[model samples]
Target: MTGFHYKGGLRIATLLCFFFILDQPAYADGVRPGYQVVSRAEIIEAMRQCDDYDPTATTNGARFQGEMILYLAQKARARDPQGLPLFIGYENWFQAFMEVTARAEDAMPQYAQLSYQYKQNTEIDYRIDRVIREIVEAPTPELAVNVRIWWEYQPGKPDRYSYMDTLSTPNLKVTNQRVMTYRLLDFGNWVAYDEIKGLTGRPTSGILGFLFRIIGEGHILQTRMAISKDGLQFNRATAKKGFIKRIDTVTVYPDGKMEKDIPPDRPDLLEIAKRITQPLEIDYAELSGEK
Candidate 1:
């Protein structure tokens, strides 16, 4: 829930450049033809402001605190298919955390009410929120990447995940993709929720569109993604600019193989592999030589 703003003064030069060339095809929407590859130092410097980016602090203060409490409550309540508690390895610590929450509630009355509601609704619709961050540096040092992924359950609304990166040049922050998803059943499967109108790839045609449908039926790997440098967009468009977002999908097989809709040569997708997919421990043989 972090408010979308970089820490430095707006680069008037970049803004002027954007205004002078806003109508360019690269600046507008749709698949970008290509991207400029920058040195490791440049990538790092572009994303310097993002080192302090905090996703948890963007929303109202109470919501995140409430979200934490609810998340813990759901974890404590999770059950396996056999109707057993899912806290196999960390049961004791999880219970201790619950007890601490109880103590907190004793210290604060409102905490008790929130905790009770969250725990009670474990059987009903609930949300499980998680965030993961990683940095990947290739051996050639061609890319120094910082990736932040947001994959979370949003009960009552269309569940979705987002990928953001700090590799966009000059401004290292941009959201490459955000896709909607939904629970298939209680058996732990989710499909892309794209049947609704107004989504990026509508009419559900073409390879990418078909890929979205296939991914809908597959076991969602639940991973998150990129930033654009030139003509890049911000989460908060102060100067009428936003992140250069693309709606793309991928399929993860049972054996851990991945097939993405993006053509292999796209630089954004290459960065996605290095910055996000590699960290998940899925082997990308093409990037096998990368560190």
Candidate 2:
């Protein structure tokens, strides 16, 4: 009843690991003479530009903003290897910029407005904006990233809910280590109430309903990543207490290919692994705002 769920779980774990890895700093020297060292003030300015991004501009202004935000993030990572302020800042800025780009590209003014309103009313913690505030008020030497997600379904009761938590510190050994853990609270239910709700539009009752929940509740999944001079290694596990109950490993090549055993049926996991491992490629002309 208690074990790792590899089918859909690996995909989620891999994605989270990939995001965390993107935040990690590369081993390199200080910033170049042309690029300025990232600062909280600079991040704020960049965010403001992203917030005011105009879809109607003659030029691809939104994309330019995104590129600038990414450039700043890279410089920040290079300048401050010990502190994650710049890295976190860049992540938040990039996310907001992407939202603007997507909305503008799709010509969805209504959705864009709604999205902006939602962000305005939401708490900083719920959004990446909180990271910006924390980095500005009090920067930490090390970053500790931990995320958790869950869902439950009980007939004749409220069926679905989810939450997330993030913390940064100076003591954690794995500065760049990223871990994503998912714990299902219901027993023997593969499909959470939310999933069933999406499909059937209502929670089903009785023995038939229980039969579909074969995934089980209280099942936990944890994925960890380690970066070395050679490449990256991702370790996945199902955990109970603080110890790993079961474990699996997947290695990613520099070319973004999987070097580990993966089931033939799960081509999705293989694709994700490749995407995460592939080296980053950016065009200088685009980033430089050149026509």
Best by TM-score: 2
| Candidate 2: segments with Cα more than 4 A from true spot | 1-213, 239-245, 254-291
Tens digits of lDDT, candidate 2, 149-208: 111222453333121101101000111111122211111111111011011111123442
TM-score for each candidate, following the candidate numbering = 0.20, 0.25
Query: lDDT score of model 2?
Result: 0.26
Note the Cα lDDT for every prediction shown. 0.22, 0.26
Q: What does each candidate score in C-alpha RMSD?
A: 22.4, 19.1
Residues 73-126 of candidate 1: C-alpha lDDT, one tens digit per residue: 233334321222111111122233334334443442222232232221111112
